[model samples]
Target: MNAAVLTALIALVSSVVGGAIVAAVNHHYSVKEDLHARRLDLSVDRLSEAYMFMLLNLTIDKDKHREYQIHLANIQLFGSPTTVSLTNNLMRRQAGEPVDVTTGALLSDILNSIRNDLGLDRIDTADLVRLNLGDEVDLLKRESSK
Candidate 1:
């Protein structure tokens, strides 16, 4: 091939190769970013499920206990170290083991740990709210009075 034509062909080839490489790299990173986002979403879902379960139930029946156990396993799997520790402490308290903090406080700590894991700002435990209905509210008040 003539020198000028050969030079033009080389330039075209280099550009095509460079573009393909860049596209490949971008696709790889995009896939990785999507995977990371999905995993984070799953973790958030699991944490929310566990927290909501805690909020809605005042007492654990057989089915509720089973559900709680599932949540516990998920927390252990997907939660941060602090969250796992807090959850373990809550479990210990539930099993009649002596723990330094109240159940409510432990729960708040767990929530804060989860928030931290999800890159959210932490809130005071006092700002934490639980929803309770008639008898449940009365029971909680009576317990607090004791």
Candidate 2:
């Protein structure tokens, strides 16, 4: 082939190869990022659900305080908040978000106190406190489900 035709063929081949590489990289990274985002979303959803359940339980009979405490403990073990692990900016973004760490901890404390004052043995004050104020929320429900 003439020089111009050979040069054109090389350019076309290079363009196709470059496009494929770019697409592959983007697809691979995007899928990984998407998985991470979905995981975070799921975590947030579960945390919110736990908070709602606790709120609903509180609206029940005060005589069921022990049961409610157990439920709170279960939420603690299950919906443990992990938002604290997020950066300050992300946490700030959650400023308007309900079921925050402070609030969750307070709820746990009140439940533990009511349970203890009622002479309940199935519950632990420190565990309740830790579960409430502890580190990032864990996938406690998944662990318990097994």
Candidate 3:
């Protein structure tokens, strides 16, 4: 074979191999990203489930709101138990240590925002345990309806 034709053949093979390697890497990275997203989704689901359970408890007994609130406080503290910072006013009094009112308010806002994102209207203690959070809750119910 001519030298040029031989050189071209080698280059073609190299290109094909390089493309395959790149595609495999891209696919691996994409799967990793999807796994991360799934983990985050699971975390959100767990948090929502806990909230709903608390709501159910509150609905069953009027005076159980405080107990449910305590459960929520524990959930918040699970990651940063010694942070000495409160996220919501309702959680402040349950803190094991002193808390900053402003930080607590900010946290309250963040929690409320999450609830709003999940289609919750209000966070009243009376309705906390037994209220429908709208479409998001409906979707969850349908998913588990089986």
Candidate 4:
């Protein structure tokens, strides 16, 4: 019957359209997810570089002082607001301009920003100490076994 053939044709066309819609939606989501993942990776790398520079600065290595500035600049470009704020707080303290923020609080803020970037729950300073201690204990056990 022509009616049956017409019905089948309509069904086929509808299915094709639906499939195309689904494929387009899927591709869009996949690209979006990949972009998001890349951004997070970039953020992590920038923040880590900044932290390394901060550590290097602690040694008072004049040669690395310029490197420290470059690293911090990279962080400023890609890092979240919290990361920038922590760097600003430390820079102020380093300049010896009498920061209202305590050294302890500044350090804690840096750690918290790092944790947040890593998608971790915010932890108190005591928890950070405990985390370090746990790793130390693992090292101790390994040493004792050796």
Better lDDT candidate (2, 3): 3
What local distance difference test score does each model get? 0.74, 0.49, 0.50, 0.65
* Candidate 1 residue-wise lDDT, 1-146, digit = tens: 89999999999999999999999999999999999999988888888787767667657788778898998888887878767787787788878889654545545666786787679999876644455655434333333334
Residue 61's lDDT in candidate 4? 75
Question: What TM-score would each prediction reach against the true structure?
Answer: 0.80, 0.43, 0.46, 0.70
Candidate 2 on 1-146: residue-level lDDT in tens?
89999999999999999999999999999999999777656544544454555544424476876765554444444342432232222234345654324433434444443343345653542333223235353333222223
TM match of model 1 to true structure: 0.80
List the candidate numbers ranked by TM-score, top first. Answer: 1, 4, 3, 2
| TM-score, prediction 2 | 0.43
Candidate 2 yields a Cα-based lDDT of 0.49
Q: Ten consecutive residues with minimal summed lDDT in candidate 1?
A: 136-145
Off by over 4 Å in 2: 58-146
Worst 10 residues of 2 by lDDT: 82-91
Where does model 4 exceed 4 Å of error?
92-98, 101-107, 126-146
Checking candidate 4 for backbone clashes, the offending pairs are none
Candidate number of the best TM-score = 1
Per-residue alpha-carbon lDDT of candidate 4 for residues 64-107, written as tens digits (9 for 90 to 100): 77887787677677666765676676678779867554434444
- Could you tell me how far off, in angstroms, the CA of residue 86 lies in candidate 1 after the best superposition? 0.8
Model 4: residue 13 alpha-carbon error in angstroms: 1.1
Candidate 1's error at 31, in angstroms?
A: 0.6
Clashing pairs in 3: 55-129
User: How accurate locally is residue 21 in candidate 1, as Cα lDDT from 0 to 100?
Assistant: 100
